[model samples]
Target: MVAGRSGNTQLVAALDRKASALGLYVGQPLANARAMVPALRVVAEDAPADAKLLARIADWCDRYTPFVALDPPRGLLLDVSGVGHLFDGEQALLDRIRAELRRQGFAVRGAMASTALAARALARHRDGCVVAPGDESKAVAPLPIEALDLDEPATHAFRRAGLKTIGQAAGRKRAELTARFGSRLVYMIDTALARANAPISPRRPLPDYRAERNFAEPVATEDIIRQTLLALAGALSELLEKRGEGARRLEAVFFRADGIVRRIAVEAGAPLREPNAMVRLFHEKLAALADPLDPGFGFDLIRLCADRIGRAEAEAQQLDSDAGRERELRLLVDRLAARFGRDRILAFHPCDTNIPEHAFALLPAQHAGPAERPWKKLRGAKEAPRRPLRLFARPERLGLLRAVDGRYHMRWRNTQRLLTRIEGPERIAMEWWRSAEPTRDYYRVEDENGRRFWLCRDAQSGQWSVQGGFA
Candidate 1:
């Protein structure tokens, strides 16, 4: 049994069959529950761990069908509509799912119907009910009003009006229900009667293209897994080639026999259509996994999916080596990114900002799109760089010292350096649309030891500071 805080008081959150038989229901106040059974065993509820376990269970359901959605706290919805025949029939598919999950020690209860809401109601009330086509209305007609899963106020209103069963409440006119208990109750009735369909949002996006291999017997050998991956990648490549499209993001899903699903994803710098390249990325990703993929009892199923895709236009055979070199560079970036991480390998993309710190943005090279603007050069090609190589986040103030014949002089870093030369005072104004900022007069000055320093003077405050350094 589990107990947690609900409002200002601790309440019973969950309990097993034995607790249920003992008349300790969920949502009962903790004090009352303890009084009812003096020796009742209760443990604190860990919501995070429970949610994670539910998510893992949803991942495990992917082998049965890709259209799996979570139904919070303790329920899962699987849209196995057209895929039911693969597991023999609808009844067999449901039975197999229940049997497998029960074998793994999960209290399973599920149902199937035309609408998601109808199935949800049945799963909660009828448990193992399977409503045939055009039978949703009849199947859910006998369930109590609580099966509709309405709010407390709405449920009480229905009960007060002597509406006990779902059939009784659904019998009322739609306009009356909408005007009284509100549209939610009306919609629930509509869906329970199969007059409307409620869509279930899948936990993950549907892949554009997919290939899978299901084994009759679980295989644990390393060579066998490698061969299976290559085979699946080849099959997926053929499909991509037929459509003249390549994948930028690819994911490989491994379903372990013990209901554990391992998913590995890799991204390419450009559209990749070659099977060898795709498999190579997966190999690098697997090798870099901190927690190595454990094949407990081997994997019964392996699936490869192209999550993001782009056009794979045929490139003309080039006579020069430049094109080949470009392709090799892209492949290298992809491999390195897979081994390390996508964010670890980045490229500078120009931003449309005059501020030195905001001039360029470092984005992941593997998935970064083209930048909008080009990098503006401060000096002409072949000329000395006008901007400093290193810029400080915040300029450090410099103290001025009266100079005579040696030209400009300043006290910086607890030392005074004699300035040999000073360049033009480049005036820069802040953007008007942004917050008000003072104008700056920048100067490129060379010190006595041939070191250059970037200095800026505030026009408003008449203050001098070092902004950057070239040495």
Candidate 2:
């Protein structure tokens, strides 16, 4: 689950507080943390688990505010602009959030400021809610320059030259600081102090249109459901047309009186505004739902939202116009995807690699369309020799008999093929430091049917396998 080598090691190093304390004295590399304290233990980090945890927290925070941004490696940013009044006050809200996080076993620090950078810096360097509005400069004036998130070497250089506090650095002439530390330092300072606008980029953009319909009574019939969906789609389509755009991703959420919400998403092959088509698409998706649409004391509300959208293009008409046909084909694919599962419908696209097994990737049909890569021009250029047309996701073992003369012959489906053409003894070594190491000698072979295949012999096990086939 670890993303990179450094991140893996850093997580392990962080857990060893004793070693970290000793290494904090003078100049010490992270690798030397174990040397300072011999019993220090380390393990690879799990980035996927971390990301999943952050995502769950983000979802849970929706009760507070819909505006949440993930701060990778740690933390999340919530914009409680107009919504803070509902929770009594800003401090009360922060305390409640902190208490909830504590109950969930998360050690957290909360801060509020006029700007994001100021909030982040204050939270990192000082106590909870370190700086309030209009007090950023006063709060950050005495903090060390390192709180600015400057690079280690730059910080060290600054400290060596006797500029320790942020106030000292801020006191210097703007031009002199810009010339010495480059624009990045100046920008960070200005952003932190609220002189420049610093924006938070959300992991996913907020949905554009949201429409909710409250029913007088629960409706369990398919006809009623379809009717309601059509109405919502019509409203959404009209809203999109006004903006000169069409919906690409749509979500339909049904909320029952019992508070359970069932949501289904549909993605269009192209931006679409047709209400009938959208309703039909959802019908296809809902038909396959395993959970019954139980009224459960009566349904309350049904909401429709557009997650992604794009500009609508003017249609071109021709005698042999395939646009209509293409639309039908895409709709057919969407229905099939909803029924048989999305992974069943796939497309193959070329990858930038000479290795046959790495030369193509399978992409979902819903997301894959005509790409503009110039494959012919790329193939014509001088580069590594082209690979085969077909490659197995993983090689299949082939039984081979070695002759006394140091040659080999293979048998496939009771048919023997002699070692007539052989091209390589290319050897690849294993990465000893990592898990699941492999070492192989690959070769190109031609059979009596004029077919060519790339094969490899495992150096460690002495087993031969067929990896790929040429066009």
Candidate 3:
């Protein structure tokens, strides 16, 4: 028996079958139970341990269905809508889940119904029950009002009003229930009767595509693990191809026999559909883990899931072609991103700004979406590029002079430069709302050495500096 503090006295939080049969029940005062049976064994209740154990069981249940939701204290809600046929039927699937959980040393009670409330009520009163569609109200009508899990006072009020069964309470008008028991109670009833829907909040997001392999005997061999991933990737690829989609992010979930789960994820800059390419990314990710994926006591299940999917259609291509080259570069980026951290590998995103330095920002390539603004080509086709290929981190001061014939001369980096020509002073204004920064003018100048430079002049201070250089 597990005892925990309840009010001023200790009460039994839980009990074993033997303790239950000995006339000791949960919520019974521990002192009273000890008085009833002097030799009764007792242990302290561990709420945290219980919660962690439930979480682990939920993770293990991912093998059965991705739509697994926690039902708190000791319940798990699984939405196995289209997957029942895989295990034969609803009854068979229910039996299998319970049997496997029992094998893992858990005493589980489960029921299926059209609604979660109905299922909860049935699981508590009618274990192993599978209510057919639209029969939830009829099925639960005979159970007591306590079946709804009402608080003690509410249950007492219903009993005082001579409503002994669920059918009796549900027969009352909605208005009366609201006036006395409140809307929450009415909602509970409505959901239990399948007249309303209560969506379960799943613990994890549903994957776009999924494939798995379950081994009868646990296997820890790296070769087998690798082969399993390859096969699952192939299966997933087939599914993705049928829908003209590919995975932007893929996760491999390893389920160890001992209820330990390890999930390793890899992301691609572009949609990835090739099985070989997907496997290679996982290889790099697994190899680069600071703490290696430990197959403690071997893994019984291996699942590959495409968490984030993107459009990918078959196209004619050549290895030397531009499209093929782009694909190769994207694949290379994915590999590099997996080896290093995604954040550590960055790409430039164009920002919608006129300031040269603020025009682009570095973001993680794998996660960065389309740029807010596209790169603008400053010069027209067949014309010299307006922006410099290389911009200095900070502008360098320069001495400038104009000759009588309108030619220019400049001294930069302590070297005198005889300019052949100088472009007009293209004016650029500073952001007025932000600061008191002065407006500036820019010029493109070429020296006698056939080198070009982008120079800027301070509008108010009359200071000149070389801002950047052209390649």
Best by lDDT: 3
Sort the candidates on TM-score, descending order: 1, 3, 2
Q: Candidate 3's residue-wise lDDT over 60-143, tens digit each?
A: 999888999998888899998888888899988888888888898889898999888899989998888888897988998888
- In model 1, the clashing pairs are none
What TM-score, computed on C-alpha atoms, does each candidate reach?
0.87, 0.50, 0.77
lDDT of 1 by residue, 1-471 (tens): 899998899999999999989999988999999999999898999999999999999999999888999988888989998987998989889888888999999999988888888988898988777889899889988889988878888889889999999998888888888899878778878888799878889999999999999999998887888889889889999999899999899999999998889999999989888888899998999899999888899999999999999998866645558987777778899999999998899988988877665677789887677787776898888988888988888899997666866477878999999888788698888777885888878888898999899999889998999999985
Residue-level error in angstroms, candidate 1, position 61: 1.3
Evaluate all candidate structures by whole-model CA lDDT and list the values in order.
Answer: 0.88, 0.73, 0.90
lDDT of 2 by residue, 148-262 (tens): 8788888997799798988788888899989998998898888777677688976556679766677777766677778888999999988988888888888887766544556
Off by over 4 Å in 1: 160-162, 216-223, 316-321, 350-362, 367-383, 390-417, 461-465, 469-471
lDDT ranking from best candidate downward: 3, 1, 2
> What's the alpha carbon RMSD for model 1?
3.2
Poorly placed runs, candidate 3 (over 4 Å):
5-11, 21-24, 28-44, 352-359, 368-471
TM-score of 3: 0.77
Report the C-alpha displacement of residue 120, candidate 3, in angstroms.
Answer: 1.0
